[model samples]
Target: MMAFEFPGQYYEVIRGTLRDVHAETAYLADWLAKSGKATGGRVLDLGCGTGTTLRALAARGHGGVGVDASAAFIAWATEAGGDGLEYVRADLADLDVAEFATEEPFDLVVCLFATLNMVPPEALVPLLRQVRGRLAPGGHLVLDAAHLLGFVDTYQPSMIAHHQRDGVLLTRMVHTSVNGHTACWRNEETILARDPDGAVSMHENGFDQWVLTAPQIRGALAAAGFRVVAEHGGFRDAPPPPFGKGPLVQVAALDG
Candidate 1:
């Protein structure tokens, strides 16, 4: 398990590399609105890296709390926090919701960007159940994972991706394999920095992720007392592709 501890410099390098913030935030805000979980409600962002989503939602007048395993990320988040927003440093799998739920029984719980995949198989269902117990009536749990189809059908030995900006260069390589229902991912990242004095430095880190199939994830939610209300291929509300292909996003509600 590779722990997440992205420093400020790392954040700066990738801040603009990802999707457009306004568009992405609006997309998520719209999803919550359509689900009847928006406005004046409370949101919980599990594995919330730097609390971007939480901050966005908070700015929209919804109270938000973000939790992540990395103290560095949480510190950055806290520094950027205000307006109906809070950041907590804790592992989602190990957190006691009662103690930190500034607003108890959240109206929405989010685990995005394949964050749910980080919870090991034995701990996944328990984590989901814990989330269920922390949701208000009619609350929704929205989560996504890298589809098994991609791992199974589009199998690749290794792939490299790189981004460079502001005198920083980041390169990543990922190697993937599957055994039975578990897909193993090994990822290595190298960061190169150049200072004003022409001094260059390099940093390297690696991590692993074990992913599950869409059906397996749905089943886990079901066993955790959730009813799958919707499923999609990605962030958009489009129909999911055939099994073993594309990402999987599931919106579930607590079962009575």
Candidate 2:
């Protein structure tokens, strides 16, 4: 079993594989509805893994642009998107957001699936502050992050993932004891048989994701000049238990 990291080809794979998960879709829909009422305005999918959330929004009639640090993910997003929906390869921290936002300001900017927790908390401030400046007054910044309770489960030896397109072996063996902020994921992936002749290969990978708590994420948003609007416990139409599995915390805020 090998570990994997994101923001590269692996990000593309994960994004493609997990694009339409039910719980994630539910989360995407919630953010889209709030942002889609802008009558033809733009929405920004920040730290967009592979533009899944952007695609979801475009399907709802909202124009979308996907931005991420991953070159491969951007390439995939570009190839996978339509006219109103496009992907850009840019660091969230370096984008001249004012120039790229088509509708003067973004009605909504969404960063999904614990994307915020992967970064240094301090770095998140400037990045989100830039996003805030690009939002129209009363517009929102919706970021889905792992609830502190998300890691309630004890580590398992491994997990098997098999789909029509691929087969995966995920192992969480390496623990990032660095401030207990990160979880290192080790993975082994192999593409399914797609050629008449042998053309597939298995690849090993490793990556790390720093985890953040709900209070920390909220405070970071606040420090970036945002006003907290609401926080749903998870996407199950019910509040998350104090500590539970796959806990996703949604933070909605307005530019103050």
Best by TM-score: 1
Model 1 C-alpha lDDT per residue in residues 1-256, reported as the tens digit of each score: 4455656556645655754557556666776676576687788899888877787788887887888888777888888766888888887668777777454678888998777876767788988988999888877888867665555675676767676777667665556544555556665555555644567766565555676777788899999999998887777768888644676778899888
Residue 65 displacement (Å), model 1? 1.1
Given candidate 1, what's the lDDT at residue 236? 74
lDDT of 2 by residue, 1-256 (tens): 2322232434544555655455665555565456556346467887776676666667666777787766666776787775588677776546667667464677778787666655554577888888887786656677777654464353334545543334432222223223343343322343332222434544444434555667777788888888776666555456656544565555566654
lDDT of 1 at 185: 68
Residue 76 lDDT in model 2? Answer: 69
Report the Cα lDDT for residue 97, model 2.
70
- For model 2, give the RMSD to the true fold: 4.7
